[model samples]
Target: MSATPDATSAAPDGGFTTVIGPRRSLLAIDLAELWRYRDLVLLLTRRDIVTVYAQTVLGPLWVVLQPLITTFTFALVFGKAAGLAPPGMPGPLFYMSGLVPWFFFSSQVTKTSRTLTGGAHVMTKVYFPRLVMPISTTLSNGFTFLVQLAALAVMVAGYVLAGGLAWSPGPQLLGLPLLVLLMGALGLGTGILISAATTKYRDLSFLVGFGVQLLMYASPVILPLSRLQKFPTLLRVFELNPMTAVIEAFRAMLFGGAVPWGGLTYSAAVTAVMLLVGVMTFNKVERSFADIV
Candidate 1:
């Protein structure tokens, strides 16, 4: 790949240009800079999708099948045995509704967490908005989320026809776009925060998986917020998780439950703070990341 100049600086003989440099403000993240690199973002997004399943036997079909398998495992382990599945809904449907969004969010966190480290070779060699890597990762994950959701839709239709579930659409369904953006922002924020940390502390990379699992439990992924009411303190803590609203709102919209406006509103504010902090931290650290990583 050729070096992409971020901006022009000054002239010595033929005008010198710096390919990669920090922005003027530590908190400054230029959205227009990202937009200017739209072609690179698309290229990276396509590469990530192709590279993920390049040598796999199942290929993209894994996107559909993997979630189905995981949903069954969750339905059995959490739904049947533990009896945490919500009342009056198909167990798989309940679990699938939560897992679909959770999968997308988790991928953004996991993959984007590696932006500085995983792509050390590329980062050291060339220059583009470092933000592009995580953005592409988030976009790449959109494909998987859509494929899995389509599979879940088929399942929901089956259950509806079999008299196991009912279709009661709610106005909250119109908020799907906002819900996805919130999920992506939260995930991308959490991810890059960890990525910045891992630059100096490589051990953080090893613990990303464990941290995400703990976070999953903190959210209302396997268990509904309603189920936590008995423990008011615990319920309060869980409600504080930004993902709690993302997953619960999604399950509520998809499965005819009531949307949690109170929790969702709180989560939106939390996401704004987190995303702002993440961008600031990334900008501050990335100027020296190539030297460290």
Candidate 2:
């Protein structure tokens, strides 16, 4: 009865035709699409975890060793030399409370920032949600974070049992998850932005490692936000860095009795904005990455 052909019919050009259909937004992170590529994501993650430490004598111990060494160095320099409060907290505890998470955040940011360049092979040859590449990088680094966390916990418990540190849970304890999410999101967003840039400017990958080290100093990693507050103008500038609030939130949740809701709120807002910008920029550039990279 109808002159119109079937929607699935081939066109005159000998190609399958796409009929008028409901439009789907391309910018969205389609979880189902990611799920379809779940096997690839898992495989990549496994590969990263296995190969990352390969040929190294210490292997997984490097995870513990890295933070342990940094904690001691910071404790001796910043904690002691600067007359900062190691407080009732032992030196290792004080330093590790900041070190482990900071390492996780920085490592994730650095690795994911090079995701595009590093995965050029998979990108050109495969059809999957591009995000799966970076997500796998993030997930792979999670084991390193877990090991550092376990090491920190053991040290903390030993310090408490030895009467070298005070042990008291606080209302701020509830904000620990929020702090972790805030840091991780900040890393993910920053990494995504840098990754997209690196596809076009390969130098960006090298810059990211040094850039992260500079960011650690800019943050309250080795000091406190309160210390910076002594210089009101300086504190204003420092606050603009998202990690200022994030690291401060870490201290509040660990040592203080309550969360700094204001700081946490600011961190959440900044991370959200960064994530949106990163995703939009990444989507815009991704179409060109295969050709360029």
Candidate 3:
């Protein structure tokens, strides 16, 4: 007697079996699925960019103006009043160099951390990878980073032509792209972890702003690593912060300084671990984010 075919059996039209069940593997990233949705990612990213400056008079110019204004303020407050500028480095250059990456990191972390909570309405209406929200936010911020970086390059060129600053391209510059990638990964990792946690505890969203501000001071955005050397313990703390290495390495690439390879290697290791943990945590919590968020 012929037995009835099971519902889970392969389709007659093709040799494909469709299984409808919960994901068996807990930590899988599903890169294939994300790739299938690339067009959506781009669309979301473009939307974020446009919506940010949609009605503003200055529009995209705000990207350049924001960093430019911050650089000047830091130069005045830190360089002129506090006397915190790095020796032999132009105060604006010094601050801009550090601020460029710091802003990118902080903005990504802040925006991406709110993805699930902010996009809740859309998430409820449709079905897609929740991870896409944070990722698209990161990409949108990356475009802003590029705009700011270009502004920085123009400023650097002006300084070079002014006969005060010495600009030399070095081998360390080759690491710039890698450094940006590491910074993004670090931000994404931390942001996703916080976002997952915030699904249950809403207070985390409130603290994120104050925490980011505190974290900036903890890193070497306004101050240089050299100044922190007198306080060995504090210097060690800064070294432990992954951003210290990234900022220092970025400055070294632009100007001339010793590349802290050991610190950078440590930061890279930490970033990798954070990313893994963040992804796993995000995946686990995302299953229930719609209900909680």
The prediction achieving the highest TM-score against the true structure is: 3
Q: Rank the candidates by lDDT, best first.
A: 3, 1, 2
After superposing candidate 1, which stretches have Cα over 4 Å from the reference? 1-23
TM-score of 1: 0.90
lDDT for each of the candidates?
A: 0.84, 0.78, 0.86
Ranking by TM-score: 3, 1, 2
lDDT of 2 by residue, 33-122 (tens): 578678988998899988978999999788899999998888888777878865445666767877878887898789888878888897
Worst 10 residues of 1 by lDDT: 1-10
Q: Which candidate is the best by lDDT?
A: 3
Give the alpha carbon lDDT tens digit for every residue of 1-293 in model 1: 11236434433334454334433687767687688899999999999999999989999998888778988899889888987877777778887888889889888889899999998899999878899998999899987888888898899899889987768878878888789899888888889988999998999998998888788888877788778889999987887778998898998787667888888898888888878888888887888888887
List residue ranges in candidate 2 displaced over 4 A. Answer: 1-26, 85-88
lDDT, candidate 3, residue 121? Answer: 92
Better by TM-score, candidate 3 or 1: 3
Better of 1 and 3 by lDDT: 3
Residue by residue across 204-270, what tens digits does model 3's lDDT show? Answer: 9999878987898888888888888789999888887889999999999878678889989998998
Clashes of 1: 0
TM-scores, one per candidate: 0.90, 0.87, 0.93
